[model samples]
Target: MATLTSTSVHTSNLFSREAIAEGTMAFRFTKPAGFEFRAGQSIDIILLNPPETDEEGNTRAFSLVSAPFDPDLMIATRMRDTAFKRVLRDAPVGMQVKLEGPSGSFVLHRKAEKAAVLLAGGIGITPFLSMVRQATNDKTQHKIYLFYSNRRPEDAPFLDVLKEVARQNPNFHLIATMTQVAQSKGEWKGETGLINEEMLAKHLPTLQGPIYYLAGPPAMVAALRRMLINAKVDADDIRTEEFSGY
Candidate 1:
């Protein structure tokens, strides 16, 4: 568990934040003072407090949604509790918060020896967002497949941006699924089930030479890991980041 003790060099909140998704907030820490990290990495946020912890007694963990060379530190967060939800949901312009690290072990392989298949569930799309943003920004010719799952069309973060990426970039393939569509609009025509082996095979029939990066809730990660293994995806080729309510 990392603490909130930033060394002052990495603290910056001069940018704005917006609600990109229903329960998600995206902040642009412009040229974040001392924040330097890989595109697929994440960070820890230390909320202001009076020494009293929340019911969970934990800080927040979020993934960087911007590329490393974007000249700004972009992190997307999912506010799931009263404490964080209140702060993020009601955050006005110019509000400041604490953030640290470009943390995490999940990143795009730089050696060019391994390709990647990124799997994201709902708000878990943060890390993969960074990877895609980096790759797209750099115009790298890597074969990447992004499988993003959400409850419905409206729940999917960066929906339009992803569709545009898929439209413009042949190196990226973005597929989506909606588990429940009670609130979905009429424009959605994609799949409507949890990510499964069959879905993977259907979209990425040639899953021969790519690694897998999975990020999402614990249950989604666990179930998807099992399914990937059962589908003969090498365990070593799969990297996961579980959002455990930290």
Candidate 2:
């Protein structure tokens, strides 16, 4: 794995906010001049004047959902009733936020000869969304296969955007699975059940040289990692990031 270097802390004013899905909000902030980060990187954000604090502290790390070329820095997170999240979700425009270090090794391998398989669960889709958007915007020729899982369509963030991206980018493919198919409201026409070896084999043309990326809750990440290893995937070719809590 590669090491990431830390940069100077910067303060950014909140530009805008919107509810992207149920209990989830996308926050856009002014990007500090000269600040740059690779797709899939995350930053530490601190509410300048939070209404309250707790054992979780005032700062939270979130993956950058905005593309590198975007003028504003953006992140999406589930709006739990926690003190930190509550303050973030209710903060108004022009609120100043402290941002520190854009650091992470979970970025795409631009020069890889094989295809990339991205496995995301729930809100874990944030980083992969960043990578896919960047790849599409830059017109990079990296072949990407994203397998995103959620309980319901309403709970999945960026579902519509990702579907549109796949439609426009020939090199990118998306396979969305719903674990709670019984709860589906309408006629759903996509893969169902948790991602497993059979599902992978059905979609992946050949798994010979593909690299796998997994992101989600701790248990989900661990389970997927083991599943990949059991399928004879090289350990070095698998990368993962665990999103602990809301």
Off by over 4 Å in 1: 1-9, 50-53
Give, for candidate 1, the lowest lDDT window spanning 10 residues: 1-10
TM-score of each: 0.87, 0.95
Highest TM-score, which number?
2
lDDT of 1 by residue, 1-246 (tens): 222232232555636778787777777765565456777677776655523346754357777788777787777776666666566555555556667675777788875556678888988898887788778878888878899999988788898888887777788899888888767675668887888888888888566557898998888898899999888888988889998873
Q: Model 1 — TM-score against the truth? A: 0.87
lDDT of each prediction vs. the true structure? 0.75, 0.88
In model 1, the clashing pairs are: none
Positional deviation of residue 162's Cα in model 1 after best superposition, in angstroms: 1.1
RMSD of 1: 3.8
C-alpha positional error of residue 21 in candidate 2 after TM-score superposition, expressed in Å: 1.8
C-alpha RMSD values across all candidates: 3.8, 2.0
